[model samples]
Target: MSGTFVGMPAFPEAARGAVHNATLRANLRHATTTIRRKRAVAVAELSDWAELREAGKQIKDHTLRHLDRYLEQLEDAVTAAGGTVHWAADADEANRIVTGLVKATGETEVVKVKSMATQEIGLNEALEAAGIRAYETDLAELIVQLGDDRPSHILVPAIHRNRGEIRDIFRAEMTRWGRPAPDDLTDTPAELAEAARLHLREKFLRTKVGISGANFMVAETGTLVVVESEGNGRMCLTLPETLISVVGIEKTVPTWRDLEVFLQTLPRSSTAERMNPYTSMWTGTTDGDGPRAFHLVLLDNGRTDTLADAVGRQALRCIRCSACLNVCPVYERAGGHAYGSVYPGPIGAILSPQLRGTDSDIDASLPYASTLCGACYEVCPVAIDIPEVLVHLRERVAQGGQVTRAGTKVVLKPARGHAAERAAMRATRWALTHPGAVRAGQRLAARTRRFHPSRLPGPGKAWTATRDLPAVPPESFGDWWKRTNGGTRDERGGSR
Candidate 1:
């Protein structure tokens, strides 16, 4: 959806380079493995984890079903509390609203909390285009910004980078952004964190405007919540005179009671902790307490279109915990950049295509990025059936793109690969429907089994490249059944 990631190739082509980068694979493997292991242990500590997970799912589903009523209720609550609310229908609108608001403040710079919504809408780039500088305050986000790179992971954006690389980024680029790294900065975790802390401190204190996205927005009181391990979000939320939050409309919960479910499940699923180190929540504004002015921009950005599909709508239930990414086999190897969106891994595989439409090469290929191992589903805190959604999206892609824009079906010509697959399925359907043809085909395959190649020829080669073709049997099951059962048939004309 953001032009920042424009011109990305399809998953197959994009992933090819990532797979060859040994260092990137190592970094992803180590980080994800550590996180997933700790998450498993943390989850095991809870006796009612399954119940909590289900409760969170139910809350999101119920809220989504009655989204319009709750959004209006939230807007009224926010307005009543002295905060202004703005509705953004798409990325451009959201960016424009935020940029205009920032420009109105008469400030040349703003500080940002780690926000996927902002990244999705390309808010930083928009601000830069308007000659406003936006500083990233989160530890990981700081590294990404200083290195002049795009975020790969959702929770930990720079998961593709190791300690040494981060140390290098800090030493080389921190001077240009704000403070410079120590002359002898080491790659140890503590040292890197301290370096980032020092680098972001000046931005936090001086920046008049703060921008953020929320983990959950309470509709009952119009409160927005941001939970994080580091204290940067707290600094950004509290210190700035003017604050603006760009949140997905789907992040809203009907009441504080519904918010309880996510408060428990999200931290454990994401950071593998019983609770985050800091959770910053605010409602409207108060004199001498936090920001003087609060602006809540509710972003739709194709979420309404995504909600139209019953099978695909479950993706809206995600809290962006990123638990699925940690456990995904495809994500472990190919890394997040291959997905080509601010959102990545298993969730991105389904979410990006729906949000952006399958018109682009990157969005079109995301559904095929997963191996359907179901690890992501098992680890999901809100019980999103990622595999089911992947299959549904694959069907949409195969049938010439089923996403709609402005009440019209937006169809792209099927990929050349899919066309071949459609032909194969058609041939398969015809043969399966005709018993005579099936019998003849099976006999033919048995006779030719010895001459069969281990690797396929033409388009089929891609499938067989990393996998073995199963050996054709010496005889068909029908012939064997007939021979073993004395050519007997039951009343139903089945083998006895």
Candidate 2:
């Protein structure tokens, strides 16, 4: 709501408080369980859902590989059809282009459809700095706007808040933005929505400019698509006389057919519906149809760099469905703000460090936020293997070297936390490779099993501080198996 994401703490520090908040945990449990169940039902309806998911993954991969070509074609098609196209390399450039466009229209305010790209680039704050107000029309975004908070989930930005908190936000903050909530505002869903609708209605009508971000952009037709449960997206896309969209390059697909695949998958995966309640599709400006003038600012903002890594590139396939977030153990407990970026949860863990680089403690800590749980991969509609990317990024962090940022290369100064982990891992590797020493150590441990302390007393103390060490096995599994089977088991079943 403050339109800023500056000076946020790293993921570990931020997640500390979230893990202890019982109320936040309750809200997360209810929302994630409900969404996950509905998603399972919606997905079951499509018998070839796995195939569709694979298709989506391959299509995104192919598009990203040829991103430059498709982007050029998209720009050509949009410009030929009466829309102006601008290329922005980073958030600052994107914000500059959008603010300049709004200023050229001579409007002091603009209505907005929920767009993560816009949020990632901090467009609202940029507009406000330049004397233009951007009003969030989506119900969830409106709640975030009024509450002066950051969105924790991609699809459901205000998933962390419940009905009661929303009513309070409306009652307390609506007047400052536009229309005021009734004095007797209650926590009922209808009352909350009505308050928001009345509050945003006037802003939509009065604003001459509409700022939006697209879910997918079609290269073959230069068409952009935005899907939302609320009709506010349609209102903002249509009611304004002038429109501007800042879209990330990753949103593009090859053709209408490709768009169709995601349209089905995205809505069901994200909102648990057969189709979105309101789907807005527009090409370059249409005469007397939608906005009379149109401008699209194509944003890279570190996306190209992310596209370069083969293993990590799958993250670019994400359609912002947030299904991964609904099933993520870390996200459910830590909430969204801990991610320290607009993108949060599993997708954020992998995507943020790539986009922002691991130079900062927050970005570096993000990749390690999870318990290496694979739930995120199971729920991802686009088939993004989140756990794989998390491990890959972890390696990048541990290897200790330089990394490219934007276009400039910078040395990745190793963090003290990472250095310690690397040293411990090296020590483990050494011990495991020396079987003679390992066997002796196991025998020693078995001999002292009864006297083994409940907690570790060295550097391992930090790890054992909050946990009880598992009782050492009476004998190592290998020793027990060998003795029982007379060393003739063959290990064909494979060692654990």
Error of 2 at 81 (Å): 0.8
lDDT of 1 by residue, 1-496 (tens): 1235888999989999999999999999999999989999999999999999999999999999999999999999898888999999999999999999999999999999999999999998899999999998889888888888888999999999999999998999889987899999999999999988888888888999999999998899988899988999999999999999999999999998887788899999999999999998888998889899999999999898888878999999999999999999999999999999999999999999999888788998999998899999999999999999999988888876566664456665676658789999999999889999999989999999989999999999988999999999988888777756745766356757
The number of clashing residue pairs in each candidate reads 0, 0
TM-score of model 1 relative to the true fold? 0.95
Per-residue CA lDDT of candidate 2, range 1-496, in tens?
A: 4545577778988888998999888999999999999999999999989988988998998999899999998999899889999999999999999998889988898999999998888988888889988888888898888888888889888999998888888888999987899999899999888888888888887889998999999998999898888789998899999989889999999988997689778988998999988888999999989899999999999887787677887889989999999999889899998999999999999999999888788888888999887998987888999999999888888775555678666776666776667788898999999988888899999999889999988788888999989988878877867765755545564433
lDDT of each: 0.91, 0.88
Error of 2 at 415 (Å): 3.4
Q: Give the TM-score of candidate 2.
A: 0.92
In model 2, which residue pairs have backbone atoms overlapping below 3 Å?
none
Q: What are the TM-scores, per candidate, against the unseen true structure?
A: 0.95, 0.92
Candidate 1 lDDT at 140 equals 87
Alpha-carbon runs more than 4 Å astray in model 1: 1-3, 406-414, 483-496
